[model samples]
Structures are given as structure tokens and as C-alpha cells.
Target: MLALIGEALLAYVVIVAVQILINDGLFGLAKVFVQRIRDLPGVDLLIGAVIKREADSFLRQIDSKRSPTVEMSIKIPEKGISHDDLREEMKQLKGEEVNLDDGQIFAYVYTAQNEHYKAMEDAYLAFTDTTGTGTEKGDTDHETLVREFLRAFMHENALNPIVFPALRRFETETAAMAADMLNGDANVVGSLTSGGTESILMAIKTYRDRARSLFPHIKSPEMVAPITIHPAFEKAAHYFDVKIVHVPLDSDFKPNLDKYRQAITSRTILLLASAPQYCHGIVDPIEEIGNIAREKGLPFHVDACFGGFMLPWVEKLGYTVPKFDFRVEAVTSISADIHKYGYGLKGASLILYRNSDIRKYQLFAYSEWPGGLFGSPGMTGSRPGGNIAASWAALRAIGQDGYLRMARRLMEATLALRDGIERIPGLAILGKPEMTAFAIASTDSHLDILALADAMEEKGWRMERQQFPNSLHCTILPHHVTLVDKLLNDLRESAENVRGKKAKGGTAAIYGMVGKIPDKAIVDTFIKQFLSDVYTCKT
Candidate 1:
């Protein structure tokens, strides 16, 4: 009787556990339902508040502290600070920043000696006005010259045909210059954007709107792109409520055309290919992709933001670059950055369309409000006239001949670096790079490339680490031309130092762990923590 009672108690415990599990499952389902409900339009603010509350509650439960911090209260000051004080503060802040002028850093900044920097400074000082044309902002004479020269024509919006006619002309001419460089026909037209990301965003949003108008049945619009495509497309899809279909790459790092074709469906509204993708710097199989798009009646956009400004010159310089621009039949649009290889100001990029009809979708216009008619091309309302002016100036100053020379210098530097890297025992270039940017990875498992990267970092050399094959990436900027040999020497020494060693600390360790983690969410959490630490407020 005792044994039977014990068995009965065991059975009862098992039954209770099963019941608990079912309740937990039901609770999880309810949470998902609530999340979907929160995603409804016009409830974003409420959802944001709810999420913040829940996040705070969870943090408290586990003792997690994550928040954006400020140096002090953001309220208006009763007293004004002196220019000397402001200058001192800025100097102190910048003292902690990386020295980009040294050409040691490989990422974030693109510097070409000091002339470009000086030019940018001059332009900035000249157009620092908040008012239309007056010195009400109280800037230097140079700013006055810049304002009087080009900025005075910038009357807020590019949509207004009456105001800022010269601004429109500047933009139109800039677009034409870029279009001609990309082998665009007479129909090709585009707009200067804030940057590469904005250019890409504009292209994606344009295709989304175009699809919506033409194929109204595509309620859940989708975009198809290679796995090697930039993250801007992902961001645009997230913002615009479009689904993304990522196609896997082949062994050669190009998008597998078969996989891309298979991934397409009735919902797919757009197609994308990148010229020299940022990771490995391999251009996608764009012509083949274009052929497919032509057959499928889809709008194909080539993201040449990385190579747009340089590739034209590269091809002209006699590099066997594959066809990727408007010359292709199915290619409907392209996004190229003038700021990158063009050596223009930081906030300059162009998004071009094959015809005005497609470009029209990217523009926004509204006259329904009491504020009267308001219209704008691309993104942002009060577009920065300074960026446009600076870009125009840079292009005029650095003519195609100048760009060709820069491209030539970079290509020579790239080849030298690639040759040096190839000569290393356990290092290899990721692909046959067509441009100045390329990746080098560890060929032997014994050599820890991440550790090598860390060692190189210790030597004041900034090398960007890549995943999958575990590599180090560098863009051969014009500034880096003279340092190619030094870079290779450092890389060789770093590889020797870190051979077969564990990257136990620093960025290498962080990246090593990140590379191994199959679940990306944990890495994302760690990133969030890092961000929180970065923003830790003294107050």
C-alpha cells in the first residue's frame, strides 16, 4: 500500500508539471498576440511606452541598468558661454578621438592628405547661416561668400519650382554628370541625397511605392537581394513594411542566380545587386540578375554607393569590370555616393532613375493642410544646402581627371596590398576584388585572424574584421596609398605574433565570441549593453 501511494504521488506530480507547461505555452501565445496588436498603426506611441515599461520592469527584476545619459540638463542657459570656452571644450572632447589624419585608421573616415579637409572646413564656415542669406547667424566672411554664391538660392524645399531655381539647376547638373558617368541614356535622372544610406533608402521606398500603384494586390510587398547586400536595404524594408527575401551567394561570393530566381514570388516588388559589396568587395553578377529582372518585369537597382564614384573611372582606366549601370536593359535605378570615392563632402550621394516616371514616385507632395502646399524630393524637409554646395564645389574642384588620378593611385595601392597579403603564408584574399576595397582571411586554422587583427590594432593599425570566413578588411583610401607597405609589414608581424594563440581580450575576443555565437540575439544584447555603457550619464 505504501509503494502504490508513492507511485500515485509521482503520477500526480508529472500531471501537474504537464499542466504548468500548457499554461506557459498559452501565456507565450497571448504575449505574441498582444505584440501583434501593438504593431497596429497609430498605436506606436502607446506600444513604445508599454515596451519601455516592460523593459524597465525586466531590468529591475534582473538588476540591469540601460539608459541614454546626458552630460547635464538640456534646459536653456541663463548665461551664455564664451567662444574661448566653447573652443577649449571642443578641443578637450576631440583629444579623446581617433586621429584620422594619420592614415592609420582603416574604417569610418576617408581622408586624402589635408587639402580635402581644408576645403571642407572653408565650405562649412562659409555657409553656416541659419537664415536665408543674411549674417543674422553671425559667421565669417567665407560663410558669407558661400551663402551669397550658392546657399542663398536654397529656399528650403526642392519641390517648389518657383523658389531656389538655381538650387534645382545645381542638382540637375550634378545628376546629369553622374548619369553620364554611369553610361546612362538621355532618360536617366536622379537627385542628390544626404548620403549613401539615404540614397539607398530613397531607391527602395521608390520601388515600394511604384509597386503599390501598379500592383495593388501586393499587400505584403517583398524585395529580393543577395546575402552580400548592404544593411541599408534591410533598414528600408523595416521602415517601409516590406518583406525581404535574401538570396544566398555562390562559392565565388556572387549572388547565386538560381537561388535568387527561386526566391522570387508574386510578392517580390523589387530586385537589388551591389557593385563591390562592402564586405568582400566583390561585385554581384549584375548583368545576369538584370537579364532575369528584364524577363520577370521587375525593377532592378544596382547599389554602387561603394564604387559608384570610382568604378566609372576604374572601367575607363581599363579594368575588366562587369557591366552594372544604366547600360543594362533591366536596370531601372542606381544609388552612388559622391562623398566616398568622389572625395566630396560627407553628406553627398545620388539616386538615379531610368526615367522621370519612376523618379516621380520617390517625391512627396501634400497641399491638403492649412500650411498650404508642401512638396519635397527624396527624404527630409529642410534639406541642407551646404551639403549640396560643398558637393558641387568638390566635383568642380576635383574634375574627372582628378578622380581618375585618385582611382589610379588607389588601384595601384590595392594591388600592392593584395600581392603582399597573398605572399603571407596563411593569408589569402577573399575574392578577385575589382576595386580598391578587398578582404584578407586566414587560410590555415592555426592562424587566428581575429587575434592577428587585435595585434595589428595594438600597433595602431585599424583593420576591420569580417565574419563567415573570418577575415580582415581594408579600403585602400588615397591616404593609405603610401602606407601599403607599412600595413603589409605590420600585418605580417601581427600574424606571426598571434599564430595559434587565443584572442582572450579586447575587440578580438569580442569578435571571436560574436563569430561563434549561432544565435545573433545574444550578440545583439551585448551590443546593446556596449551602447548603454557608451551613453552612461554622469548625471
Candidate 2:
């Protein structure tokens, strides 16, 4: 009887344990589904309101002592204002309410000088009211000149390069130019993408498709990259259903090549090395990683979106930037943005492959469409030709010598800022930055990096806060050279002001919370809700 009772108790305990485990798993799944449901259009507003309220509350606390407070006025005007009146109002707001011209902001305005600003404004005005038909027969009118140029240069559709001979030529020429800049030969080929994100997406998608084709038995395609690599790769993995293997970086923010190599397997398709990554602005060990990729016969991608234009110029300016381009034997591809450092309009970026054969994989084509066969080289179907014209114009106008001069000035300013930050007692620079972008963090026990950022914001500085290390980040531009000392002074004062203040709220707190959340699904749902809210316009 005693033995039977003991056996019954054990069985009951095992059953209960299994039931508990099952229940917990179901609960987690249900939570994810609920969060996703909340992210839908109608429901997302509630989440957004809550988040905005939280952020606003935090901002108020941070700016309580400041005279001109950071506040949000969400209500629309009762009556529509004239364009001229609105422009005047905006000017007044800037002069009276908020003035970023005090030289505290970073990166957003590359040319803050009056002459450059006026030139850009004029360029914008010249094209603002123009409209055009297709490229042919449109060059005579101002509205159609850009359109005609684009039509003459490339096809309306990027996918059908054969049908659009001009697009093929333009793409080929652009790729060649990029490859030459990177020290590659005729074997190099690439595609023009919308931006850095699309370029990354194409690379990831190509690798994923190629891996599946080659290794039919491997269900999951994996990629290895440093944690500091741009978040776009993570987004790529999410979209394409590939597993990501993120390797940690060294103290200097460079990737550990050995660990990266160890992470690689037969199922691995690509390895990523950023030429001065976004967070701390430290270049990875690209040569070593490229060699590894060659030995393993894997495709290596150098993400030079930030450094691509600048690094080449910096090299010409006599800076010892590491080799991170097609010149490296294993670097099969690269993504470089013209919008950021290239001084072009937004929405222009390029992705280059080692050769046409490899780039062919990025193309999407279908003959069964009712619209007489459909194909696209990159992501977009009908890209605006105006953007292309502007990008081409900016590149030609800047020229090589112009870029080199800008690079020299920017580097000097960056060094000066670095020196000033180092002089501060409680602040420490993150790593040996290889470019103009760098991050600063607090070494003092009581200092909160986010609080410091908030304090700076109160001073009309729009600095970005970075995670992984909790630091204040900046991306310097050519125009920032004149205001570097002013920025340094403000930063020093802000640091001192927020020395003992706890990080309360704002982007810093939100990101800090996001980092702590173990389940990424919930965080993703929250972010989706936030984005949906941003797009939601009340009637």
C-alpha cells in the first residue's frame, strides 16, 4: 500500500510540472499575440498615447529648470494658414522658441553655413513646382529637364535593364565608379538601392536565396556579424527567416575575427564588417575577416554607408583608414550611401557586388504577370528620377578635390572635439574612432548617460543616445567644424549639470528599458505600435 501511494504521488507531481510548463509556454505565446493585435491601426493609438505621455512627462522633468521648456502642442490650428504666413510663423518659432543655430545640434545639417544653406534652398525651390511627363520630349521645359535627363540615363524600371538600356548603362557606370573608388577592377558589379537599409536587405536576401538554392537540405540560413553592425541586418533576418549569429566586439569596438570565424558553419551565407560602425565609430578588422571569408569560401560584405564617401576622401586627406572595400579579396559586396556624406539629396544609396554574376541573384523577375512580364533590379518599381538627377548633380559638383578639402576640415574639427571631451573630468570617449563619428559616456558613478543627453536637449542640442554601452553619440559633418568648440562647451556644462541626476525619461529611458527586455517579440510589437501611431493621422 505504501509503495503504491508513493508511485501515485510521483505521477501526480510529474503531471503537474508538465502542466505548469505547458501553461507558461501558452501564456508567453498569448502575450505575443495580444501585443501584435494591439499594434494594429485602430488599437495602436492607445499604445502611442501612453508612450508619448510617458516621454512628455520625462521631458518636462528634465527641462523643469530650463527657461524655454520642451513641450508638445499636438492640437491643429483652427483655420488653415497661408503658406507665407506659415513660413513666417516657422521663422518666428525658430528665433523665439527654439534656435538650433546656436551650434549644439549634430549631424542633421551638413551645411549650416548661410551660403550653403541658401544654395540648397535655391536648388529645392528650383525643382519644387516642376512636373514632367516621361523622359522623352520633356527636356525643353524646366519641369521636364530632370525627367528627360533621367529617362536618357536610365529606364523607368530598374528590373528590366534590357528594356531600359540607359538604366543598365547608368547602373553599370555607377557601379564601376564605386568599385574604382574602392580599388576594384572590371570584375566588380553592383546595384543602386534606395538607401543603406535596402542595400542591406538586398544583400541579405541574395545570400538567403543563394544558400537555399545550394544547400537544399539546410532549412535555416544564418549570418554572422558584429553586434555593432547596423540594425538593418537584424531586420533582414527577421523578414527573410534567417538565423542571426551576433558576435561581440573587442574593447576598441572592433569585431573579434576568431569568434566570428568560429560562429560560421556550412549553412552560413554572409559575413558583415562595418567600416566604422554607427555606435562608437570604430572600424572592424576587415582584412582579417575578409581573409577568413576567402578561406571559407563565404561572401563578405563591407557596410560603408557612413564611411564610404568620407573614408575615400579622408584617405586622400592623408588619414590612415583601414582597407575596407572591394580591394579586399574576400569582400564580395559593399553598401555606400550618397545622401549622408556624399552631400546629395535623401534617398540615394548604392550596393556593389564583386561581379555581375553575383549581382544577378539580387534581381527579381517574373514572366507570368498580366502586365507583360515584371522585373525589378532592386526593391522599388518606379523610383523618382529627380532624386537620381540631384544625386548625380551633387557628386559632380563636389568633385574629388572639394570632398578632400571638406574631409580635412571635418577631421580637424572632430579631433578638437575629441580633445575637449577628454578634458572633461567625468566623461570618457568610447573607443579610438576612425572617422568623424564618435560617442561619449560617463565614468562617474552618479552620472546617467541618458540624463546627460536630456540635459543637453534642454540646451537645444539634438544628440542621439546609443545602447549596448549607454553613451551619447554624435555624427559630425563638414559644417560642424565651425561649431565644434561651442558644442564641446555646451556638452561640458550639460555633463556637470546632470552629474547627479538619475535618468528619468525620454528616448534614453525608453531605449534603456528596451535593452532590458529579454523577449524581443514584445519589444518588436511595441515598436510596431509606435510606428503605426506615427503614420496615423486623425480625421
Winner by TM-score: 1
Candidate lDDT scores, in order, read 0.75, 0.72
In candidate 2, which residue ranges exceed 4 Å CA deviation?
A: 1-169
Which pairs clash inside model 1? Answer: 126-142, 126-143
Give the Cα error of residue 150 in candidate 1, in Å.
8.7
- Per-structure clash totals for the candidates: 2, 3
The candidate that achieves the highest lDDT relative to the unseen native structure: 1
TM per candidate comes to 0.72, 0.70
| Residue-level lDDT tens digits of model 1 in 386-470 | 4575455445444566667777888888989999999998999987889989988888898988888888888998879888777
Once model 2 is optimally superposed onto the true structure by TM-score, how far is the C-alpha of residue 423 displaced, in angstroms? 0.6
